[model samples]
Target: MTAGLRALRRRILTPALSSTSLEVRGFRKKNPTAQELLETVGRSFLEGYGRIVEAPDSQAAEPRLEAIPREFRGFAYEGAAMACSIMDALPGSGGRRLSGLLAGRGGAHTYMAYVGIGWAMARLPRMLHPDTEDTDPLLRWLILDGYGFHQAYFHTDRYVRGQHRERKLPWPEDQASYAHRAVDQGIGRALWFVGGTDVDAVLALVDAFPPARRGDLFSGVGLAATYAGGAGADELLRLREGVGAYRPQLLQGSAFAAEAREHAGLTVPHTHLATEVLCGMKPHEAAGVCREQRPGASDRVDMPAYETWRQGIAGALVSEGRS
Candidate 1:
């Protein structure tokens, strides 16, 4: 594509910046700093998305994405991944754009990239969703996580306020039944943003959901709180206390965030603080827990390896009395 055509493609594909504003999304503005930070995340995501769509390829977009500040670079990569996946899914655009990016520098941000694919899924039609049948079974669930977050973030009335649950997703044919749980995890993450990082409000929203679903929901909250860093020490402590019996699950989510941040070399001060408060360990230690408990390839088919990995991390936290 010519530069002009690519620029036009970017403009057509990218959502307007105003769409991310707290007022525009009908999300709360608990405080100015929190609102600004969250809005900045949206802006950074769009910047990344625009860069990838206008460039010739993911590699061609790297230098500009790399120019993003360290604090929000991961989100930019996420936006880029989302755009690449969207491009791959579009008819007549030769596929594998996502795979090629993943094989290159995007490897460091694998977790975010997969979530980005989920974002693409939200925008594309069911028939056009990226193929994940051959994706790592253990990590493909993260795509649903991304999808859930996208739904809850943009369609809050249905997924969050109405407390709707996705049932038996059509993708991942063999394990479709487990899709809703993964989606709920993403919803939980979005709730953190929806509530504007207000611990009490977010907890109230979680409590409103059916008891059975709260565990996965809390897990998402933990991941967002740790990775996104909107909540403070006291708020995190309150969240830890509020979760009660789901503490292990919450810690598991925190560990997942820690692992992603650590692996990508994006650990920030809030990551450390959140891990310390939520997981009773440093960010690296929490990430180590995730690494130590990751499940290897297994013939067992009763549960997805992804679930096993999560259960293992949660169990490890419980066994060590860290929860």
Candidate 2:
């Protein structure tokens, strides 16, 4: 693409910075700190997206993404991954952009990258959705998680307030039913943002959902609480106590977040704090649980390895009596 065309694409594709504002999203502004932190995350994501849109290729966008502050860098990589996936899904685009990104520094941020692909899926038409057949069978569910987060973040009333749920997702053939569960996990993550790190508000929102859905939702909450860091010790403790029967799911999500941060070399103070409170261990220890529980080659037709992996983590938490 020519420079002028790249500029045009960047202009067309990038969302306005105000879109991240608490006022614009109508999300709760529990406090200035939480609001500012969440909005900064949105800005970082956009910066990464814009960088990729203007770059010649995903690899070319690396330096710009790396320049993002450590706390926000993973989110930028997510945005870059989202942009790359979107470009690959466009007609006659050769479909190599996302692959190239995952092959480089983006690999460390694989969890975020998969979520980014879900972001692309939300904007693209069904016909243009990138094939996930080659994606890691276990991690690919995060695409739906990302998709769920996008819908909840952008269409808050319908997905969060109205408690809407997709009937039958069309991707991941033969396992479409499981997609809703994964999406719920993303919605759960979004709830953390939507409620502005207010433990009570988030808990109330989750309680409104059906019983079967609460586990996945709480799992998302755990991931966001650990990864995002808006909630302090008191808030996290309340969150840990509030999850009730779903505590294991919450711990599983926390572990996943720890693993993602650990893998990306982005482990922050909040990461450690959240894991300590929610998982009864430090970030590395929680992440180690994730690594140990990861499933090997599995032909288990009853459940996807990804779900099996999640269950394994949750079960480990239970067995260890981690509260």
Candidate 3:
């Protein structure tokens, strides 16, 4: 357990540490030592992801969302834990300010973006090592929640029916063009969430995704928005376009083989729930909106929720200066 915790601290929390403040001359900043920063980031990251918000008791619910499974509700609260964790783990240079900044909409953007990156990296590994339990339950949840259990695609479909059957499936060639753009947008969402206002890095990363393309970039943003819950009318509109474009062409038989159908079913309703939140509805209100759109949609509730949780935890690490 200690080794696992140390690995997570070094690997995950190191990136968010404040390098800018480390070079300052003279008497040193408050709690800005490397060890201090490491501790802060590690604690924050763990606490953020570790927190599992239970369902709220009656009368304390937010106005816009509807009732949902315990896991699906309190995304903002979860986001907060993540942000707090991130702030706690990071160096103190801008620690408190960074922590507060993450509480705003910009923080939400960061949480979702990191979730996307983490999800993309972990997908195939889960298939290859089905026996090894993944450390980030939230990341696992988000991945399965968003994409579903299309393991056959990795194990069989791409090798059999996909465009690049000669090589590995979900390879850079197969999904990177689309997924890369989404990644860029996901980064932008993080910037926005943190209130940084700059998006050059986000766009640059998107451009860097293996099969870069302009149209793909635009679509990626829409897809990211859809995954993050759209936030407003315009975002939702973009999401619709992206989803429509990505649907048959991007997914189809390649990602979803025979047994994978149930997993594929998870996308739409969760998108609906995300859209509700992105459109400014509260968690329960968003859930209501989702239900209104698709009656009996409860079955899709827990498809893969841990991705969001993982993101929340990661963000918390950044905020806490632990990551």
Candidate 4:
């Protein structure tokens, strides 16, 4: 790690740049043994990244758990769990490297590592301030709220990739310049604050998809959870409830395509891992879903469209006096 990278990561920690500044690291290859990957993951945590490691794998068919080096145990279960999910999803068919699957698609671990950190930051407040009233609307509505909590709790970001740009907000008018800085810096810390393993669990599940696919999935599903009792509470709730009834079939590839066409008007296409987080499905569920829906699926998950829809909906809800 260079001092430049460290300073950059810190600078991004400012509230204004938090959400937009995404920290992507780890995974130089497809399946860089748990030991090697864990080292970088630990360094990332120490570097103010987030503390998340994978739990010991129970369903590995090959390379048995014993194969993992003893020294790697020091890393948190959250990181280990995420690593297992990434490794488990590689292309090999039967755990074979599948060459391009890991490297060609911008690296699964990188996507997940960033996601894991982001997830933790989003959830951190709950772990620390369990009882405190949340003053931050962003933290309260998106991260901690319960209702559509199903979507936000897990792989929503697998669809909603954070975008970077200058923007203004209605609240805290005096601190209007803070939005960009918040996305860049505070977002990471927000995710990290969520605690380690819980965040890792979400990423481990989502990391299976390629970046583009992840974005696409999130975009199609549109908005999930948003703020309540502030500005757009009523309308936002209506939209949330409208979206709440829709459920993913848990099938992959063509089914997703079919569902997209079928529900084109009513449902949004999101790569939301409902089964994984709520039902406690195994990590491989992500791989299974992707394998079924996306042919030649790379490790990328799309969040572009989902994000666009979110901003649009949020703005609409706020303006209509429903927030």
Candidate 5:
């Protein structure tokens, strides 16, 4: 089902994508806004596929993007994450290529780009670190999250990993410590892609989160289930039974996926179909929620922020558990 959806998405997105060649550095527009600058990163990612082959890596200086307001700086990573997705689809060592391109950015941009790497790696889930699988839930997510960051620079900084290794984990001893908020958000959704839905294995790792961290864990589970189109009705139900108390988190993840699909420019059918299949929600209910917060045409989707703020009721239920 996912394969079919991918095919259809490419078809729908192609026409619009084809008309515009990707423009990375040279923004002819004078005084681009923060949102425009961020949006460029995603469009450049699309453009990179089209132009990178023909256009030599432009050593010519890119026009300076204005300072990203502190609150919205994380958006840089979100944009870079979109680029990483494009790079991952390409054959061979794209992470190295990505690192080089991002080298010139601000410190936050560079760090957040690794979180993007985590997001991309979730799609393919190369578990370079063995401990991630057997470790406690918090450690497991961190390792999984770290692996994505690690892979992004694997080709370029393979040996330099030790230089600032401790900085990556603020509390190296604490499994739950993210060291970086971007990584904390990046991990849970990513776990779904990286950790497939082996009910016992998945739940075991999830159970390790304790009640405090389960919301994030549940989001990952929901994302994996929705995209795991093969999860089937029975398996999804089985999953619900095992971790049903966190259904709100699961639906939030589903909505996140749904919003992303729409942002990818796929029609509602493409996005909501997977939700309908994996979420086991009433088709209309799922579709309604999907469209409820769907981005208006050409708007940027701050999915991380969206996922962080879930349906109020879901948030309330999960919050109640917190107290």
Candidate 6:
């Protein structure tokens, strides 16, 4: 990459540039590959994630995740939103970039790539219709997600031909497969987060699938709800109690992950405190521990640990993307 492009990549990775600073990368049809974008996402929020949260409206593309509660940042929902926010900053060529990425073999490998696109699509309605306030945000989110999924799978941007209502899901599901059915299920999951905590739609979507396929679908639902801060400690506990025994740690871990990321972004000491709390330490004790260990700005933070915490939770959620 040219030095200019490298600098641009760094800038894009961190979140929420002031609206004034946007377009400085010089928008072109420069649709960087999925590999490039995947790399770029790493830095987007590393430096300024907390600042973005501190004053989200100052950014060019307002991150939808900022509107949600902070408890779910560890959830893939925030990942998706971050991905979407990144894509929104680019031009139409982003569709091509996303399509190329999706062409690869499916599995845990491509899960994050798909998430970036899903996040972008989720924000499209608001981006496209800035003044319109739809009564049903969940339904709106589903439409955007489905449309983007169709475009990615079918490799076309012109949805107007039929708006992808007639896409196929002929691929049979198995333990290793992520058929077109997974896309539909994921869209259903995004709905629960963008909408209220109402799970009626989520349960219905889960019922539509075999018990085997429900895990992948519900993973999205749980992650989205938690990551988007739609669920609190009480609600998370209730959700865990109600769901299959396979998912409690993940839901809780996602919340903790969000907390960790937030604290890390705000100040490194908070990161330690958050980790201690997640490891079953009392909040008061964790806070005291972190207070004593807090380091100066001259010292580098253990950002790797923070990233590891995020990846650990998100990776598990994506791995559940079975057929």
lDDT of 4: 0.26
lDDT tens readout by residue for model 6, 1-323: 45566456546554443321213321111123322322232234232233222222223223433343333222223343334344435565232222222232211112232344344444455344211131122122232333333342233223212223334432122311223334544443433422234444345434554555445455455544433333344444545545564353334333333333443232233233332323233333333333333333231123323223333544443343410
Error of 6 at 313 (Å): 6.0
Candidate models: Cα lDDT each: 0.89, 0.91, 0.29, 0.26, 0.40, 0.35
The candidate that achieves the highest lDDT relative to the unseen native structure: 2
What lDDT is obtained when candidate 3 is compared to the true structure? 0.29
lDDT of 4 by residue, 1-323 (tens): 35465345334432232222122221112223322332343443322221111112222211222232332211122232233323334344232221222232213223222233233334333232122132123222222111122123233353123322224321244433432222322222222211121223223333343432333222222211100001122332332233222212111221222222222111211222322222122223333332333222121123222233333433332233321
Model 5 residue 3 CA deviation in Å: 31
- Tell me how far the alpha carbon of residue 290 in candidate 3 is from the true structure, in angstroms, after superposition: 3.2
List candidate 6 stretches off by more than 4 Å. 1-114, 119-176, 179-185, 199-201, 245-323
Q: Write the per-residue lDDT of candidate 5 for residues 163-217, one digit (tens) a residue.
A: 1223444223443243333243334443332333345555655565446666655
Candidate order by lDDT, highest to lowest?
A: 2, 1, 5, 6, 3, 4
Q: What are the TM-scores, per candidate, against the unseen true structure? A: 0.97, 0.97, 0.27, 0.23, 0.42, 0.35
Residue 289 in model 3: lDDT: 28
Q: Give each prediction's root-mean-square deviation over alpha carbons.
A: 1.3, 1.3, 16.9, 18.7, 16.7, 16.8
Instruction: At residue 145, give the lDDT of candidate 5.
Output: 43
By summed lDDT, which 10 consecutive residues of candidate 6 come out lowest?
130-139
The local lDDT score (0 to 100) that residue 5 gets in candidate 3 is 60
